[model samples]
Target: MNEADALDLVQFAIWTVLIASGPAVVVAMVVGVGIALVQALTQVQEITLTFVPKIVAILLTVALSGPFVGSQISSFTTVIFQRVQDGF
Candidate 1:
């Protein structure tokens, strides 16, 4: 409710979002970069080549990370609700 508490809550929410998404995003980015490098080296220059692998890698990462992500989000939600109940 106070300005400082509100700011902290907002910051925590942002961090939670980043933590939740970071693994998948990082995997996609790395896959994209590697695909780009391979294309550059082989002179393939196929745009779809970049997209498909990144998508697949991200999907796999999301699948593998689902439980961890869910737990993080659930914990954050619980903390937020508890704060709300505590009159924050």
Candidate 2:
């Protein structure tokens, strides 16, 4: 493949990865911030306070978003395979 085609493929791969992981990352960030705020307000400066909620939230997000993420990855993979078949 030419340089442009290779770059396009790399960009697509990165975008697909970002899309697939976005929900979990967002959930984790939100949960972490919320927990940190609570800790600050309540004066409970326990570092461990952040982990459980973040983990749970990320897990829930993954569970809820699993099908969508899977479909996105599957479609990207299909496109990549098709591009290979097309000799791009």
Task: Note each model's CA RMSD in angstroms.
Answer: 0.8, 0.9
Clashes of each: 0, 0
Which pairs clash (backbone N, Cα, C closer than 3 Å) in model 2?
none
Off by over 4 Å in 1: none
Tens-place lDDT per residue, model 2, 1-88, is 9999999989999999999999999888888888888998999988788887888888889999999999999999999999989988
TM-scores, one per candidate: 0.95, 0.94
> For residue 10, what is the lDDT in candidate 2?
91
Give per-residue CA lDDT, model 1, range 1-88, as digits (tens).
8899989989989999999999998998889889888988999998789888888898899999999999999999999999989987
**Highest lDDT, which number?**
1
Question: Quick one: how many clashes does candidate 1 have?
Answer: 0
